[model samples]
Target: MKSVNQIAVAVAVVGISVSSGFVAAQTKAPAVKSSTATQAKSSTMLKATMADVLKASQASDWRSLNPENTLYLEMDKGRVVIELAPEFAPKNVANIKALVKEGYFDGLAMIRSHDNYVAQWGDASEKREFKTAAKKVEGEFTIKYQKDTEFTRLPDADGYAPQVGHANSFAAARDPKTQTTWLTHCYGAIGVARGNETDSGNGSSLYAVTGHAPRNLDRNITVVGRVMYGIELLSSLPRGTGALGFYEKAEERTPIKTVRLAADVPEAERSKLEVFRTNTTSFKALVEAQRNRGGDWYKFAANHIELCNVPIPVRVVK
Candidate 1:
């Protein structure tokens, strides 16, 4: 994990919501949108509801930030690409970045695996019940304000925060009442762990999402961002037989050779990856197309997409 230097900022935006039944019913639409590219026009007529219209409205109003701030984790199986949310958790992001460049995770192992929850990796301290050996460098866990943060907000209602949106390129929660905001624990999410205190665990020990929506972790821990690609690698790892998914033997643990930042890698060595821009006409149409409105196939269109489930299609161009 790498900590980005950027900071988090709260936005005055409403939650985003889409119904499931209607969207699920409307499955086959002809005129569709592109998942991975910018489509010129959508041929499908979205029988969009008033709410879908609003959420799509914010798509045009999306706030895209620098990809240089993106963090890339290198595992033996493959590189797990993660975009860090500095705006929501600056110190956490920074600490991760520093650790990555320093090769702190060069020889660590993933010891914990909780099904439908998180897959964690760090100093696999066996015979030790909860040790903080990874905390060589202590950092502030949370922040009050972040300047120049480009927060792309969701219009759907969230069960977690006053508002929900994308910060540091992941689904997020914001609360004006407390002047606070943080990352939401959605699938493919990456988070920092703390023991008892709010800032207990530094960026040294971290975890990634593997299963369904784990909203319980929201606001309780620091969720950085969602996995942009190669989630199959992390989510598919074998489950541990012991409690908390702790491997019973040293051989059972997954070794982590190193973690990296995309900025640090050479262009040739770096993964030639392109993430579909969030605020695109094609994406909006794709979302609408996926919902299946104005079609016979779909009995009803959900007219909604989850922050975690939102298909952020990634591809390597030929």
Candidate 2:
């Protein structure tokens, strides 16, 4: 009979032989055609790039600006188009519409152009008049959230609000617990300038954010709308020398030839522009494309996007 050590060595050899036989069988096995077919399917259905998503967008994916809610700021260089957010700031919008109809901002100059901050335009004269409306409308900083309100939420972490999203076409923030929603101060955001008093801003003086998003002003000030086009017309203006970017010399100010509501203008004279609707399947795809950056140029995907960083595409209807 074999000794205990000899028997153990024989058992080990047998185990090694069995393992080698199993490995050989696996190596000789035929590959599955299903894997290659799956790969081909995946390649065919690869994620779309931002450009591809936009190219695939349909006519219904875009929305036309309501003429009643659009404002055309005519200057020497060109027209600065703005889209008002009546859903967010109804009181301010009402006041602004009245002012625009009354020609309150027709000759008023763009008084301030604080670099990387805001470009404000209104009557600089001490004795400015609001011939069409009241001097003080209740502050419409935030409105009660309505369940019926159409909101398209972004899937990104925000340092500012509990929830960040877009309502209508405006960047907005909401607090579900409190049922409150307000427009954020994003690039090209148009806000009413107010004094220390809360109700002071009656839509007379307006400012457009030309730089980084100042989200701190979201619930503190009333945001009327956003610049839909010709942002460079305001952003590229010379920085004011005086404090708070007030032009020291009157001649330095850019004159506002006229600020008219698109509804008041002739159909032929109005700007033919369309904005991508936020609440659409194409928009969701567009947002995903932006978040991932599926193009070959990007070495790595970001996977996340900020609310303000998302581009709300606006194109002149061709």
Q: List clashing residue pairs in candidate 2.
A: none
Runs in model 1 deviating more than 4 A are 1-68, 126-149, 279-297
In order, how many clashes per candidate?
A: 25, 0
List TM-scores for all candidates, in order.
Answer: 0.70, 0.85
Over 61-134, each residue of candidate 2 has an lDDT whose tens digit, in order, gives 88899999999999999999999999888988999999999988888899999987999999888477778788
- In model 2, the Cα lDDT at residue 253 comes to 98
- CA RMSD, predictions in order: 9.6, 19.8
Model 2 scores what on Cα lDDT? 0.80
* Angstrom error at residue 94, model 1: 1.1
